[model samples]
Target: MAEKIYAGVKVQVDQEGYLIDTNQWTKEIAKEIAKEEGFELTETHFAIIKFIREKVAKGEALTLRSIGKSGATDIKGFYQLFPGAPLKKATKCAGVPKPSSCI
Candidate 1:
């Protein structure tokens, strides 16, 4: 793990760039991470990010189907939002660990 700065905040992250501590996440941090991932955050993206964060905090398993059913967006829309490697990208930007489901 390594420490990185985002939105002027320093935080620890894994080799793949997922946050090592979700408690360090903030909207600004999320925006910076999303920007680094080549996209911008919208209310739609925030809705999904919020959903992901909540689920992770509750120790629930996260999956594409769960996210698609989140009413934030469907699977196709989720793909469109994050583009390549949607789940991995979304989890990364949401400041959560990369889901075990991802390779």
Candidate 2:
């Protein structure tokens, strides 16, 4: 694990840079992560982030197809919101472990 400080909080990250401890996540941290990825969290982005976090907390599997059906956003819309690797980037912004389906 590697450590990163965001919004004055230290977080443990995995080899792929996803947060290891979801509890350390905060909205400020999410904003910082999104900014570093050249993205700004709009309402749509926040909805997706919230949806991903909820699903992760439930120990559910995440996938592009599932996210599309999640009603948060359609598959095509998800691509528009998160251009490349929507699930991966969104999960990272949500401060959760990378979904197994991501890689």
Candidate 3:
């Protein structure tokens, strides 16, 4: 793990950049992470991020189809939101570990 600053807060992250502690997450941190990943955050992105965080906190497995069914956005919209890899990008921005289904 390595220490990184996001929105003026220092936190630990794994090699892949996911936060080592979810308690360290904040919307500002999410924005910084998103910017690093090549996109800007939006209300829609936050909505989806919130959903993903909640799911993970509750121990529910996340999948592209699960996110698509979230009512936040459909699959096409998810792809458009995160670009290259939706699940990976979304989980990273949400400050959660990369889902097992990712690779």
Candidate 4:
């Protein structure tokens, strides 16, 4: 059996085994996604930060600007992709001691 899932949590397990739900979209699940994506959990913060930084950098280099300049569209995608790292806590997870490239 498995615990009841609420919101977008797609997985369920209760001393039995793993059962993945296709419709789920939660932080803990996202964390698992990143892990499956070849990123270590302990460094997930760094992973997301770097991922954001890279994507932002790529966007900026072409336009001779920065990630902060992308406007609404960019912001929306960022939120969707890294939903686990909420806007409020992204900074701490990024682990950029003092902010480095505006990700």
Q: Give the best candidate by lDDT.
A: 3
lDDT digits (tens) for residues 1-103 of candidate 3: 9999999999999999999999899999999999999999999999999999999999999998899899999999999999998999999999999999753
Query: How would you encode candidate 1's per-residue C-alpha lDDT over 1-103 as one tens digit per residue?
Result: 9999998999999998999999999999999999999999999999999999999999999999999999999999999999999999999999999899742
Question: Which residues of candidate 4, in runs, are more than 4 Å off?
Answer: 1-48, 51-73, 97-103
CA error at residue 13 for candidate 4, angstroms: 30
Clash pairs detected, candidate 3:
none
Tell me how far the alpha carbon of residue 22 in candidate 4 is from the true structure, in angstroms, after superposition. Answer: 36
TM-score: the better of candidates 1 and 3? 3
TM-score, per-candidate, Cα-based: 0.96, 0.91, 0.97, 0.25
Candidate 1 overall lDDT versus native: 0.93
Candidates ranked by TM-score, best first?
A: 3, 1, 2, 4
RMSD of each: 1.3, 1.6, 1.2, 13.4
User: What order do candidates take by lDDT, descending?
Assistant: 3, 1, 2, 4
Residue 38 displacement in candidate 4 (angstroms): 16
| lDDT (tens digit, per residue) of candidate 4 on 1-103 | 5654433553554332223332243446545544443443444344555554455444432221332344422555445544653442342233212233433
Clash number by candidate, in order: 0, 0, 0, 0
By the lDDT metric, which is better: model 2 or model 4?
2
lDDT of 2 by residue, 1-103 (tens): 8999989998889988899989989999999988888788888888888889998899988888888878889998888887788888899999998778953
**What is the RMSD of candidate 3?**
1.2
